[model samples]
Target: MFDRKEMMEAFLCEANEELQKLEIEILALEQSGDSETSIKRIFRVAHTLKGSSAAMGFDEMKTLTHEMENVLDGIRQGRLRVSTELVNVLFACLDALNALRDDIEAEREAQTPTDRIVERLRAIGSGEAGAGGSAAGSGEPGHQGEGGGQAPFEVGEQDAAAIKQAEREGMQAYECLVKLADTCEMRLVRYYVVAERFNSGGQVIATIPELHMDLDVPELRFLVVSGLGEAELKAKIEQIMDVSKVSVARYALTEAPSSEPQIAVAAAAPEVRQAPGAAPVKEQEQKRSSQTIRVGVDRIENMMNLVGELVIDQTRITQLGHLLRDRYPVDENLEMLEQVANHFTRVIGELQESVMKTRMLPIGQLFNRFPRMMRDLSQNLNKDIHLIMEGEETELDRTVIEEIGDPLIHLLRNAIDHGIESKEARLASGKPLVGTVRMTAAHQENQVVLTVEDDGAGIDPERIKQSAVRKGLLTQQAADALTEQECIELVFMPGFSTASTISDVSGRGVGMDIVRNHIEKLNGLIDVQTKPGQGTTFIIKLPLTLAILRGLLVNLGPSTFALPMGSVVEIVRYSTRDIYTLKGQPVVKNRERVIPLLWLHDHFNLPRRKRTRDHVFVVVVGVAEKRIGLIVDELIGNQEIVVKSVGSYIGKIEGVSGATILGDGSVALILDVTGIFQLAGTPKKIGSAPDAE
Candidate 1:
């Protein structure tokens, strides 16, 4: 017996995928003029849903799908077509399906859901409550009369024979078993993959149930009509990673004539249509490959994790080697063993990196969705907007890509809502009616830079200052003293917004602050730039991946900290001459560039007794176009520190993004440079100060 919850989850998951496709296709059909084919596609989705619900004993879904199928048939036969009224009803049906789907997903929430819906159907001449292709929907009026609706005119004897003849002679058949790996990330995708494998082979034969059912099974079994033998089948299954195994069998989903190959046949009606409709059908099949074999993602990740353990083991063994070599100076083999161990260490390091790369998808995959979003938004707003996206191909850890979507969405909405001006205003200013927003990305040394710039109305620094003062986020005196750059950054301050009126979209000004906090949590930075009436641009600099970071290890007052390499420029020895106090703050001059220096001692609130040493080591950090020197006691040499932010409250005051096993085997804090910057530099206002009278 299968774990019932697992089976239900798998089924709901598959149904959801099909529903997504159906929604997209329906939307596309609305945009197209093809009513005949659209109805056909809709019917197919309904048929599949109907069969799956019946198999699962979901009576409500089965009834709903049945009603939907009838409506689709009415459209298919040219008696009805997609109208605004019909589409609205379809949307209602879609919503019902979605609600039902949600119930299946989390049945705990399905309290007294739609149990018994009204049944609507119409028959030809004789009205009866029987299944029919042209049955009316429950959402529609049910004509009250005898034999109002019936399933359909009964299939004639010749039509039934013709259907059997087509199945027996015209169609080919084969059995397909698609077994997913226990570690398969998405079982539905695996199902699609297996379907694609067979579809590429040739044709498919009959299968059980008059309708195709979407099973919520971990292992999807279907019979295909393919000419390929066992060898071809094995080769194809091996191609898809996470496909544990595939074993084909002879039996179809149902029993057929003994003289013909067994194939699944919808037992609902033995009748078939020899002349199928000529509507163009798209194949939603799975991916197929023949050379490579499948390996579970978990297995690979596990192997990489085990290698990490091996690294710790190697660290221990190396210590042992050093102790042994010192005790027995004449031992030649011990020294050689140390060298071999070092080699393995390098190999394991490279292997771990390679494994991580396997999970790295290009940022472009997420970025690609924005063009369509922009297109829709532009049309809806009746505003001419152009988006310039660059460096979208930059790759990041998949984990980062997933979380970044919503924040980016909020930013885009903010830009469209407040940053861009109306067409009339643009024309009055002699600018093009279409506003331009430029989004660029590129790797700088070790960090990824993403920028969103709009050429409409540049942000007003004075407005921000006024708002900041009003919100008590800043003192009026502080807002007055802020620079133009600092003014633009006020948006990052919680409860700080310059907009006077709120709209459906933005105006709350909370989004930018949230974006700032979220990125900071990821050890990333966000900044804004604007010139009044020219444009506004938000520049976000993020690490290559949240999973790994290159760090510079430093020591300050008995504590070790890691500075991200992407943020560091040069670690230089500085004398008191290089650093001078200006207005109570320490500043360092390097190559004629004044870099404000933050003392690690004072930053950490450690004991600040004056050091006798005159020379100080400074780590120069850069974010956006600004640079600052961080004062540390000494550089403990350069080492790669992987940043891991711990959340389960590990009980330590560890401020580092992650910890790494040092050659000396000690825990170190990976310095949050951006966090430290917030600790250090006074951010310049992001907008301009008012002009002096």
Candidate 2:
């Protein structure tokens, strides 16, 4: 019943976790030179990955991890030191491991080459390159531990006590020396298998170099407290492949053998022991593991679909109850039906919320990936930049998290390449030598607002205007007429970039526009705020979840449409007298801001309804700084609507993002606020205008 596919998937998952931790710890180690804790963590992660890869028969991954483990072990034992070059080599190893993991996940085998990285790791581990600090102990495996002359298999007080307690329980303590074949390529893996065999029969008190230490030597010694006699233990060790010789001798507590050269104790036993009255860590871990299980994303999506169906049905039942009450006025069951509908509505609402919550994940998952990227970028650009992140605990829908990573990455790259000044320039400008780019996420009502701000040379509006004109994106007159904010907005224009030269990082003029498009596709908003000399901040606002949303349904002639409430700033009943022409376009004045008015009937090519009253309802919708007041014939009440994609048969509509089913079973197109703005074109003027109503 061995499930190879399932085992590979589990290995892939575990590898990803370990690799992420290694990257974080490696960066920390570089920051705080000679951090023992970070070194140990890095060593542990590499060792875990080495063991897992070996078990899965991924030779490439196992080899790479084994070399990485050696290098990390060297650093941990203080035989090697951390340096910039050493850190870069470690990062290279990490990148190789990631590629290997990706290959295994996709092709069921690691196709990435690890020979070069392994050589580099070996070079560093042997003190040949990029390695500093004392070059103690011949760099060979099983050399006496730090500050030589202590016994290699020496047991600590706690381990000796455990051995004595096991002896009292009728178990015999024995010293087992297992020697590997001279041609054994994976000595560590072979040792691991031997250790597992010992632990299966009885407890392994300890090992000579310890499990995580250097295991490249020909021989490994294990202190075992087992009920199995010497013959049984020797037979067990002989069964393992690549194990050349096995010798088991009864251990005497009184004497230190003079025949064997004494070596220092490397590390304590790997087994964790708990204090009195405390729950065992292994038991607690098992309890925790039992509490949670990995459920696939597809299952969650299916559940969400089912919830959407329930919501639709619930809406239908409530509508049916309203009809029953209104038409059949004092029927006996109408009251009960009404009560049941109300209760069902409550339950469905709760269910919808719960399902959406299941889809929610903290934004930190996305934010944590940026620091390492920032580090590499800063180094590449030769700029002194510090990236500060905040509000990572803010939660967003998993779907949103998946989509937002690319946009944020583009912004960070632009921040480093275009916004942040170089060290010399910063000094000349009287700013700090190290530029800081801060990324923060927070919950703003029903939306998640993320901002990436950089204290570099704030984007120059004049330069943007000039670039726009030079690139033929705009006429000189047009560019000159645009205000500073509008000039900055020009960056999002297709094929628009302010960089004088194109490079690998950016400057081909293909990033910002795509960033904006991706955000809009999620029904989100991205805006930029900049000052001349201070900094620039790109703010993105996205919905908490896309599966369900509160939508404002409106009537345009005989057709109904849903405007996402996230984009709907406010609804205003404007008097015909309040609407006037500003440069031949119908405009409305709301709170001193002039917003262009659009007729949905004209946009959708439907017949316009004549105004029968002096006032009109305008649903003001906006994304970022742009606002357009959409004129509707009638205002339908808001409701929770399930979003459904329009099938490919109908293709993509211009202003309609998607469609949602109503209580009456009719489909209403969900209006895309960003698309509507595009269809509306750029507004001409926003100044005071004469009322021509």
- For each candidate in the order shown, give its overall lDDT on alpha carbons: 0.63, 0.82
Q: What tens-digit string does per-residue lDDT give for candidate 1 at 104-157?
A: 777754443453332332231123423222233434533223212212222223
- For each of the candidates, give the backbone clash count: 37, 2
Which predicted model would earn the best TM-score?
Answer: 2
| CA deviation > 4 Å runs, candidate 1 | 19-54, 59-99, 109-307, 311-331, 362-395, 423-449, 453-455, 531-535, 605-613, 644-658, 681-693
lDDT of 2 by residue, 223-330 (tens): 898888899989989999999999888874532111111111223333434534447677744543112345567788898999999999999999999898889998
What is the clash tally of candidate 1? 37
